[model samples]
Target: MSKRRQPSPSHPTTHHGDPERSFEPYKKAVILGLRWSNDDLDLVKPQAALLETFRIQCGFETASLVIPSTSSEEALNAISQTILELRQKYDMDRECTCHMATLFVIHYIGHGVSETEWEFDICGTRRPDAVRIPWSSIYIGMKSDVLILIDTSYSGNFLQPCHSLQRILQNNDHHAEYLFSTGNEISDQNGPTYDKNNNFTTRLTDLLYSVSPTPVTVAQLHEALCTQANDPSTKLRYTPQYMDCYKPSIIIQHVEKNDYIWKIENTTRKAQIPTGRALISVCILGNTVHGQVKEWQASLSTMDSDVTIEGVFNLQGYSLCLLSMPISLWNSFLHPGYNS
Candidate 1:
């Protein structure tokens, strides 16, 4: 007779190779500041100042500042040149080696009519009504991991086309890219105010500074700002909104062991005794009648030996054994429930 072989281990295993860690060299950050309204230069001034401070604090290997025409025709030409330079440097052309480490920080501090149109002063004249910052334009020559900050009316509407937090989490690319907005619906007609004590940009700047030691997720930042804004007396309300609309059907390329585990949990069911039992019985059902017959006979094998045959047969109906496999084999069996 042939000897039986023990089954191999069923659990998935992972091997971590030799650890080779290296720090990423300092990257460049391009700051695009668009402050169109002359109504509150004070409110706008700090935004630009905060950007400069953020750049200095980041200590990047390289940085560029682009301020479009907030005042004159000359400003328009400057803005166009700056935009062109940025496009050439970071756009998909791959012309500049610096492009790989570049992070475009487009800051729009003006007024947005809706998701599509932003009214900003290209020149001091304010003759040109509203310019559209197409989603294509925003992501032009950059990686998908860009960080965008817009402080304007209807800024929240911009996220109307991006993916939501729930989708992002489920899809496993929660950190692919992020968008941060200062208000919801639309900027209040009451021009942005700077409460000498605290302002939106300043508070955010402080938060970023504090976040150096602890990396903050986009969701965490949103929650923190919301909590502060809810308070009644907080000098400057920081209303941050995450763009949850644009569901680009791109399959996230990067995959980690954790990502697979997360996907399995979202897509599969937890192991249960009844489920396991059902699966085992189903698999063995067709193999032999002997086990089924024995199970039936055992059900009739009651404690009371004195019980009559009729009584034993009656008890047999209630004595059926629900077979179950070991917990390790749960994944190997067929799924018990409905399919997606």
Candidate 2:
């Protein structure tokens, strides 16, 4: 028998509205997951997860400014403008409706200013704070609804004046949502649970795959984050905060819960595609199942067992067969996969 292709696990997705509905929210989104500050600060897992989530789960066309690599001020500014401009381009390119479903997300996986005042990444010999860009400057330019996720460990004191989401949104006319990694004290957000990234992002990525399997709204995400923060099962707690959102109900796309996941690679290296082959585990009955995929596809069944799976194989390996529609329909009789 040949080696079974084992993709990564099944990630989560959210439904901003009903996926079955006529009109959907968050069709267009712009995301910037950067390690663009100091050389000592390079974030891996969170950035990778965010990129994939928005593309596969959120289902929004995305533009990633930089990952792990440092970005110049000019480049950062261009990215900010690109956010507003991308929406215009998305609507113009597609002849959808009078209004297009769009969302803007600014997710920082690395450092934010100091352990005190809030700030983003930086470069050059200038003082860290000098090169740092205030949160207000960049986010203020946002054209559409926005969600900001700060996975870095910074003091909550800097945010004292703007403690509540209601206060944060009250000052900014455009709706904004905020989620921080910790409340105050020292944060354990930097722990490595995935390959190179921290524990929080890896957990978050899995949460999207498990919590909601369709386009999700900001409120739904907040709930899931809160559960994880206070989850008894988890030793690592992350504080999730949000309020006064213009459309907390607006959709944010992500990975599906039931996907026959096929990870593009197998490596654990940061900023590189895996070994470029998907891996999925399976159990074959006999040689009879090998003659044609259809046979294995047909003989699929299930048994009750205690197992934790990143992605489930209902009828054995499933993504390849489903990739080509004719095979999918030809094997429509195949059983469905499940999550543990």
Candidate 3:
């Protein structure tokens, strides 16, 4: 797909104040799974299937293509053609009242080079048979939202070093650009076994399924993957990194959940909308006493009135608090013993 220039800002779409109506804009979803060899294709196939199923369930007309061979120029051409057809089919170029209802999900599992030279080589060599395509060559224009999951050696190279969270929050028509990767370098791939179930895609798919029945955003998915990576049992080598600029946030999966309350009835829980913003998780080491947890939450909230405790959960013998704080306090908050 040819890279196009950014378009002028369009009118803000009105969603009629209905939360569910926000997701109704998406009409079509295209999933492209790229792999190097037949062995990798076998794995990519199932992963693509899982993604396709999720997209379909989200009420979008979905199409999936598992393109094999890192060396085949034909494969690249196929991807380009598919993107072209998608643009035409969705009338992505036309400036309508709403953003284009097209979601592009790409999964690339192969060997990648540095960030500047963001190219994938079949055998990591510049041989005649090996096809090396730069990431810039791929169509990542501003027509639709894009989610790229890369499991390459230097997959983290795809990420932008810094992002503007405020821009994402303010811009209503801003289509998302999300990149989730294994790690930046080979050393980031730690641990022993990197088998079928232990690889990045496997762990990703697991979280995708586990978070079902609860609509999950890219930020939530990345946080879940990081939790899995820290766990020794999951066998996930590298911690995944996410780089996104999504307005109103992008929900990758949508599943219906019954609204039921138990003993905590008539009580309202602050809905933590994961906007893929600046959220930090803090762990407090201690018992599970309600008073103690409340004290910690109070102290943190007192320090910065703007700070919002997104979620609180216990894990690995410690209580964790997911906090949304102003960027100004990030330096002090990130330092060790700052709370103490």
Candidate 4:
């Protein structure tokens, strides 16, 4: 029998130096087209095609589509099932090692009514009356990394108050998400108009096809749409006010990050500490070793550092804390010190 060597008192035992994982290539996307009138199918078809182009450009391994021409219930059910199935198949805990991200795009091209309450006729059936597709339902079952696009009138209803697209984009979670819409809370009675030769759909189709070779960010796409909307000669009435209402709603519960975790303490009030105070202790853990740990105490009002951690030592009165440590060493002290 071999005895396990104990880790040094100053150093914890663990592995480190693993490169940060990426969540891009493994993304999955689904585009749902609801209630596109027969007159607008010509418009809808191209949008669907554009989505496929995005699917390919983004390298999404799996893609699905749902369109309801007449029955809203059937369409909602199909979309819901597709979401559920995809979530289960590529969930984080699944045995498969593949990283899974998802994008859901819902486009409702039809009439919207807000007299009694917010409602839209998606494929001839009223949404709230015939088949309700709440924001919660549509976004349910989603893990950390997901993007949602809602191209419809009154799409702002899907987003909760105070949540903005900028904030969503700024989120540091590895699995960040986004949501966008084609218009604001108001509905356009005339709907989208077609051009003499290429309608709104065809133009969008052409743009998407041409832009496929060069991958563009969501902001770029929005800029393109805005430019098209602002073209004075163009008959198309798609305005930024109409298509840019959808913002990002970050569900903090689903944030994904590396092993390093952060917690804000005494955030309401600032901590007062004297200058040049010595740190009590320092600790680190991870696979890779030999990295130096650094710490600094900020001045009461200025951004200058009053104290810092350099050599190993034990001091009194001042706060003792770990700034940064190897992942392996950090995990050792995570649990109550125990023997195996």
Leading candidate by lDDT: 3
Error of 3 at 43 (Å): 2.5
Candidate with better TM-score, 2 vs 3? 3
Position 264, candidate 2: lDDT:
27
Q: What is candidate 1's lDDT per residue for 1-340, written digit by digit as tens?
A: 0111222232111011100111122134455665543423344565756566555544321233434434344445554576567756645233223224344555555434332223211211212343333222232334423445555433323445322322222233232234444333223575444242354555566665654433233334444555566566774544444432122111111111244231111112211111111122221222333455465445534422221122111132243233332222222222423111
lDDT of each: 0.36, 0.43, 0.48, 0.35
Clashes of 1: 11
Question: Who wins the TM-score comparison?
Answer: 3
lDDT of 4 by residue, 1-340 (tens): 0112332232111111111111122233444444434333244555556555545443333444444545556556766776676666655232222334344444444322322222322332334433333333343445433444434443323332223323222222223233233333333486434232334344544555555443233334444545565576765555421111122221111111236332212222211111111122443232222432332333211322223333443335333343332222222132222211
Q: Model 3 — TM-score against the truth?
A: 0.56
Question: Which stretches of model 1 miss by more than 4 angstroms?
Answer: 1-26, 37-40, 61-80, 87-101, 115-139, 153-178, 182-199, 235-238, 244-340
Stretches off by above 4 angstroms in model 3 are: 1-25, 37-42, 66-73, 94-100, 115-129, 140-142, 153-176, 183-193, 253-340
List, residue by residue over 1-340, the lDDT tens digit for candidate 2.
2222221122121223232232233345566564453424446546777678766765545565552223445645755676557656654244322155345666665433333233333332223433454455564343455667656543333333213322332354344555445323332366432222435566667666663444444545555655555555665544444442423234444433236432222122121111111123555443323346543443331211111122323353442232111111111112223110
- Model 2 residue 157 distance off true place after TM-score fit, in angstroms: 9.4
Give TM per candidate. 0.43, 0.51, 0.56, 0.43
Error of 3 at 100 (Å): 5.9
Candidate 4, superposed: residue stretches over 4 Å from native: 1-44, 61-75, 92-111, 116-139, 153-204, 241-340
Q: Where is model 2 more than 4 Å wrong at Cα?
A: 1-27, 37-39, 67-78, 84-88, 92-99, 114-130, 139-143, 156-174, 183-199, 253-340
RMSD, one per candidate, in order? 18.1, 17.4, 11.8, 18.3
